[model samples]
Target: MDGRAARETPVHLRLTHRGRVVFGTIGTLLTAGVLALLAALGATSASASAEQSEQSFSTVVAAPGDSLWGIAESLDPEGDPRDLVAELVTLNGMDGSGVQAGESIAVPTRYADAPGVIPAQ
Candidate 1:
């Protein structure tokens, strides 16, 4: 052999017997990892979107002879009755100025009207 060795092909372009097979395997693995990452991101966004569409509220309906004002007054006694009224209206699809007995309404969280709590939009 001469003092200088033969110049071999570059690693990426080499076509040795095992080079092609190994390179193909590595390429496939990298591609799979990238695709998996994309799939995870897509799933996360879809779940978040579904979450935004659905919301839950809690309220109790009044029995016959019970007054709307009384129900409003009694809900979350520690919370702001006004905000409770708003959440109730928004949740039950009731008229802003009207309420009736036997109607279910959502009560705002106790924290909703508590001091130092940020008001809901």
Candidate 2:
């Protein structure tokens, strides 16, 4: 034998049945918690954005020949006029679609300054 002795090799790491089960359960719980947290964050941001972009109102005055249907058509020529008329009535708390000249009416902010749409204030 030489003057130097042989060095001992390190043993490989091993897990028992119980050890494997415990580690697997911990990993699964941690993964589930992370997924849940991400989902919650995503949902919160979506709702916050929706709230921030909510519709707003502006005022317009009725012209001599202007009617609910005309205003609606001017606002969105391609879209249905009835729907917009209903919205106008609802916003201004009108009993019907009738309006007098120079009467101030509330309209959605998006359609406030469109062509033929006169702003009251």
Q: Each prediction's Cα lDDT score? A: 0.63, 0.83
TM-scores, one per candidate: 0.36, 0.48
TM-score of 2: 0.48
Off by over 4 Å in 1: 1-13, 56-121
Best by lDDT: 2
- What is the per-residue lDDT of model 1 for residues 1-121, given as tens digits with 9 covering 90 to 100? 8754677655565488798889899999999999999999999999996795355434455666755455666655665667656766675667663656656555455534543233443
Error of 2 at 10 (Å): 77
* Model 2 lDDT tens row, 1-121: 7544566567799999999999999999999999999999999999997785464456677889889898888788998999989999987779999999999877877786787555544
Best by TM-score: 2
Instruction: List the RMSD of every prediction in angstroms.
Output: 10.4, 9.6
> Can you give the lDDT of residue 85 in candidate 1?
66
Question: How many steric overlaps are in each model, in order?
Answer: 0, 0
Clashes of 2: 0
